[model samples]
Target: MSSIRGARVAALSAVVVAAFALSACSGGATDDPPASAEQTLRLSAQAPPSSWAIGNAPGGDATMYLSVYDTLLRTTPDAEITEGLAEEWEYNDDLTELTLHLREGQEFTDGEPVDADAVVASLNVSREGPSTATNLTAVSDVTATDESTVVLTLSQPDAALLPNLADVAGAIGAPDVLTAESSTLEPVGSGPYILDSSSVAGSNYVLKKNPDNWDADSFPFETVQFQIIADPTAITNAMQAGQLDWIALNTPDQLAQFPEPKYTSGSNNANGLGVLWLADREGTIVPALKDVRVRQAINLAIDRESIAEKLQVGSLHPTEQVVNPNGGAWSDELNETYSYNLEEAKALMAEAGYADGFAVTMPSTFLSTPYEPTFSQQLGDIGIQVTWETVPFQDFLTKVFSQNYGMYFMFNAFRSADSVDVRGATTAIFNPFNSTSPEYEALIAEANSSESADAFAPVNEYFVKEAWFAPIFYTAGPWVASDKVTYTPAKTFYPSLKPWAPAN
Candidate 1:
């Protein structure tokens, strides 16, 4: 139920205002007094850093890379595929290779023709590049067969090939523009927007319209500024001050403040899975998490209904499956069987030898704070005393990934709607038989190798019913535009909302 909005929302909103101003100047304002269509959209965020370059680079930031750049394909909330840089593609009978036909005439801001070579170059960069999504290393090779045709060969028959390409790692940019250092701050891509600047500490990113875009006529906004505001109250206040067009409200309390059309609710196909990591480290709580019983007890004690109501602000529905309700070929199996039950949780704790109780501290960040209360409440109901410590996301990433924190929340968005598409990465997390799970690895492996979607249904059922992960809710953040801005409705999140043209 915790409402949250991303800082990128404010950045795009600013660009939307700027584009409006340009529109007014282009058209004569008549007797109503010549008002310059030139709009200087100002956006405010609670504590967003001023600079962050998110891309194929090592220090890449997520919000910058996704919000300002474009992807090869897009997936809808229902897991359907839509055109991105590639207008269409076809796979061989074996599903081992895919040939994509790039859209004609699409070019980077630098005017480099978006051709087969460009596609190969983009993929190669990520395949061997330092990126959050380094899994592309699994790609065998990329061959440019013709001007617009590029064929991709993977190590295995990846049914989720196209959908995976929709990820940020697949952002298509110019070959020449990419350099070891340039990636840190400079971004050159075929998306509607271009990177203008990045904050000193790599916290925020600024973007502008790509005038040379093949669809420039449809590209609306002129400029955008994304700040690293991570605080919910500050995000809400910014909206009230007209400093933001749209933001991802992070908590239920934050959502209640909005009246109606001004702020709306939508389901994001992505979901966050609760993780109680067990790796040992200093000043950490993992030593206790190593016990499977403890992990199970925590999952059982969660009150999904209360959390959804308090934080969702009536915008979302609780989820059981890792996939969203609108999930595609992979999520037809999700239902309400995973309800909350405090009694079962207590029993699990007792079985774990903690009949009295255990005290634990959860390391969390801005994105996870709103959910902390709900987590704490549920644990308390089961005789567990929980204290949550708030940490910055950047710091947490640097610290927690190394086992610095025992328990935390992990977020995974569906790279594609296809079941095969999601299974690849998700398998890495839940696979219990991997060296990480030595004992229960079969549970995760079965779900991953199952040839038929139906065959994997049982394994998938176990993960959901066992409460291995406490599911929250799915939410699609609303993109509220100033009526003056005009845009093409995109099925995915990559298309810049600000580049939308201004009303004449």
Candidate 2:
């Protein structure tokens, strides 16, 4: 199948951790095929979806959403925009208009032709629909130039438009599927793979493969089953018992128990934004947080090394910036500003009249297995009494939307390749904080108005300097492959069996 070739040149699939790979080596085949005629891969994770609704579901559902959907464009493991359903694409000089060239003979699993109109309808639904995760609201109109071509006209130049389109929530579906019922069903896409079957039986889910993929017949595995096993010991037991081949190490103890799984470490963009929200409550410690000294105290107290040593799984990289190190435009200018300094933290606390170090409640989501608990402890060590209120991912979002939490994790899902001036980050937090920063607002406008992406840097610098949002480490997961299963890591997404076979 022909797909966009040029974006691959720019590393379109810029993902923090490039551990997702095909299961085979480059130009090498699995030496010994599995004994079973139909290979069933048992993949395990802590994330289990309550419903497959992209617009409504809380966090922890990205894994399933990504695997079972398709977008017009995708990010490289390194965060570049590569081609997907569209064979080729071009952004106008002003960055306001984008044209995508679709692959010929592409059809959804449900037999609907993957045409330009379908793409337009799918995007429009996400724009006007209840899917808040679909960051394409900036788009004003979408028109099919022809059967194989679609043109997207944004209200303004959105530098991150391509990467935003890569979002799983923005996955294109059959027009009729959206109209069928309010209930969720299998999403129809025109990617190289398809969801053959998915069922949540008890705590486990089974997802098979569609043999009618548009790509070449190189993918070795025929079926992929995702098991939602909660117990770390149970996961280890499954691995030892040969009942499971791939299992995520949820905690440090769990990772220690199973030391042999090949560990792949990288960064992700899910780390919560560093924010100093103005608390609206009548009586609260947050009014003090309005002071820059207090905010600086919070920043200085963060010991990223301890968190890395204690919480980072399978050798994931430690970071101090929200955009991540692998993210091309990530600014290190703020690094010295938020560096770990207990003495400085104490001084700032005293300066803010909190020499006693006030106690505060830190509401967080248990869905983020690595960061929340560690972050709470980091603040606790610096004389700030931190009481963690672990809530579900959905609850966290609602609380944030209401601005009820003094401090919480808000993961900024970037839709475009890492540009220095991040419109999504600004739009997500800035609008809530101070939508009127002429400089910040102007940057967003300028980024869209730039003749090319090269002109976006000047405006992006304002965000990095003003500390509108604190930077945190990238949140990438470990990709461990059994010795028996050798695959190339596809950094842009979760590991798949597409590129591998059984090793001799």
Candidate 3:
């Protein structure tokens, strides 16, 4: 099975290379300038869609969804919520109900009107979809109250609802296309670009400008092509050869390869928590990890600053909390508590009755994280033995989401606009590690009910004090683009086309 998957991936890469070559010569007239002079932009990305269905793809595939469909609301890199399909929205005084007013005279590419009914239909479909189920867990009902008004009623007050709506979960598809069985292959949306079916999935994708789109003027490119080149070396080679206009720099080393005069580069802090998972707090996997002191000891043992400076080479910011620095829940007091002290860690380990230390197993992935070696070494110094279990990327994701690991390290980007968004991020990632403690449950409930950052601060402080998960850092990477196009990288983990424009 592994070999078969590898063969498919290799074939896909070859197809992308071929399609990219073909795109340069196919579209223009003989008198037209060279392919590089055309308004079309070419991008090389790591993941292409396995399934184009909105609900079937992972939440991280927001860029792909946004390319074809527009959400009810849009979130900026700074986490601000702005209008998308819906022109305006407001929550009722009690906050259990949200009312949205649709933009006037909008239509999907299929020529169906985008109104209250359309919004309700899309929301209903998303609520039942696997990728979006968690985001809409609180939503009880969606109703089209009138031609232009749609009301969403929640079982309880949830601060993250609006922000989640700004993500891929809230993407609105055309009713006609959505109801059809071929919806996955032929998506119809009201966004600035329409997906061209001529391109193959998982290899290459072509998006033609939607001239009839309401926000047509907002999009500067006439065409956008995405080539799924999984190999990092191939992506760099393609960029240098001028076959690709934009590429994301996964490492700081790639920064030097794209120099000035010919290319432009930009970066922003990624919107997620880089977490050290000390899962199995209930003693399901490692008996020693059940104690809160043990978790705190592990947190104090690792030198996060050194790892960021040496391994990451300043590409990431060492973070003690899961919330973004600008978020309302971020606390200077809490961040100060995470100073690395070996003696303190040793003392905590003794207090937790593990002075001799205990052994724990962790799964290893193909992608090497800076935390792995440092975590193992520091924990070993404090008498903890770590046994590594090597696994593929798919198996790793399955285990992490299934809560089958004792210890693991990974990062998650939370699309946060405020303190309420901080709480939302907490719920989305940390809920799986939750225990049956009444105090913890009460804190979570209060955080969920909060409407502002001030109300959510205590919950954020509580998680930090408990040392639930050790946050390593906030990551940011470079987006290298050619001099012909002007682009501003979104403060997100993924690249987006919405912020791109022609250079002046």
Candidate 4:
């Protein structure tokens, strides 16, 4: 795995709450004997998969299913795009239509032929299903023009379609299973492995290699097993005692226990720490937030470096803009746009007529509580008070888009500039009240249409200048593996079977 890259033109395997590793640390066992009997790759899942059905799959964390489903397209170990069930695929000049040429003689566990009709049926079922439907909204129709060809007619152009095909959205299921209500309990995919029935629902899940797999080498292990463990300390202890092969180093600051000789580590380019103020740019809920001066002042009040140190996950450098440094829209100069200046912050607040300070309601979940103290103490000094509303961890996302909050903080997923500029800024799930303006919409269109990723420069600058959101840092998540396990990150993806290998 030279690099994690297959860029719809990118890929999330999710991390732990209040954690994901910060840096990469390489290790070796040159002087020790290599373990040869452990061929079955063993690891832990952040949580168990709720359903085996691709359409009704889990959101963000698909660590257990990546090995069970072979999508229409394949993403190589290096994250490069390649052919899968559909041997060849092409898009029309305007990019409104896509054609997929299916491979002959492929079959699912249920003996269903992997043909054009099957692909169309599978995709159509996923289009209407939950969890996967959002990515396929632009697809107007799916039709098998012939026995070997499937065409997708879209109402509008989508730039993320390519790499997205390698994800759950591109997963092709047997037509019978797709139509069956029991599909969620029983998976009938043609990937490297099939879910073993011996497994329990939430405790442990196992996968046995698919005898008729098309790409067996991508997943070298004959047996892949996952244990649902939420505590990082427990995971480290398991790996230390040789009970596990791999786990997420969610608590990067506590890596002293996973010392070398037995363990090695790596990370993925994944996310950014930030607070989405939600819609209400006009300050309908919190009038002080409507003023540009107050928003900018809030940006200045943040001490990114301190937050990075306290969080102890991801990079040490605090981020300065919405777009990641790797994305085309990123500008190095923007990092300097909002440096810590409490005096200047006070001045801006005073200018906005908030010299006496202001209070606003904010939501707090287990996933976001780690940073609450920093915001409370830092912002309090600048005259802004925060009142927290406690919400259950499972209900946080539902509360975010539905309720009006002055701000909510979390590590935002950053696969590419397209995902942030398009999905985060324009979609109803993330932007319900249409927080963006016509001017920002034009910039988004430009960035999406441009041949180069750099077309996002204007958009990145605008995000920082407008101070609609406060970005603290960018991160490449951490993973610690046993000496016998070789790890390769799947670029935008979370840890999965494709990136873990038996060192032998």
Give per-residue CA lDDT, model 2, range 85-194, as digits (tens). Answer: 78799877767788899887777777888788888877776776544433676688889989999998988766556666765445677777754553265556555455
Error of 2 at 190 (Å): 3.3
- The TM-score values for the models, in the order shown, are 0.71, 0.75, 0.87, 0.86
lDDT string, candidate 1, 1-504, tens digits = 111123212111222111111000000011121133354333333333222223343221133344445667755423456677788888777666778888888876677787889888778767765342445644688999999898888666544455557655567777776654555556667776667654333344456667666444443445555554545556567666666654444443455665665544333323322233323312234344555565566666766667657655444455666543433333544555545767776777788777777776667765566567766777788777877777765465455545444555544332333343235324432322222333234654543334464544554565555444555554443333333433222232322343234445
Candidate 3 structure quality by residue, lDDT tens digits, 1-504: 000011111111222212111000000012122333238877765666545565554433345557788888876644567788888999888788999988989888888998889888888888887667777888999999899999999888877787778766678888766656687777888887899867787788898888887767666778888777767678779989998876655456767888998998765444434567666678776788789999999889878888777765545667788765666777878887878988999999999899999988777764434356777898898899887778776565566557667777654444544443444344433444554457666876787677665666776787778887787776554557788776654443221355556664
Off by over 4 Å in 1: 1-70, 76-79, 104-106, 135-137, 196-206, 223-231, 248-294, 329-338, 352-361, 367-377, 380-392, 410-415, 418-459, 476-504
202-292: candidate 4 lDDT, tens digit per residue: 7777889786877664556778777766555575687788988876554455457778877886554544335445456767667887788
Model 3 whole-model lDDT (C-alpha atoms) = 0.65
Q: Report the Cα lDDT for residue 408, model 1.
A: 55
Q: How many clashing residue pairs, candidate 4?
A: 11
Task: Give the lowest summed-lDDT range of ten residues in model 2.
Answer: 1-10
TM-score of 4: 0.86
Candidate 1, TM-score vs. the true structure? 0.71
In model 2, state the lDDT of residue 9.
9
What root-mean-square deviation over C-alphas does model 2 reach?
Answer: 7.3
Every candidate's CA RMSD: 8.1, 7.3, 7.1, 5.2
Q: What is the lDDT of every predicted structure here?
A: 0.49, 0.50, 0.65, 0.65
- How close to the true structure is residue 91 of candidate 4, measured as C-alpha lDDT? 86
Model 1: per-residue Cα lDDT at residue 448? 34
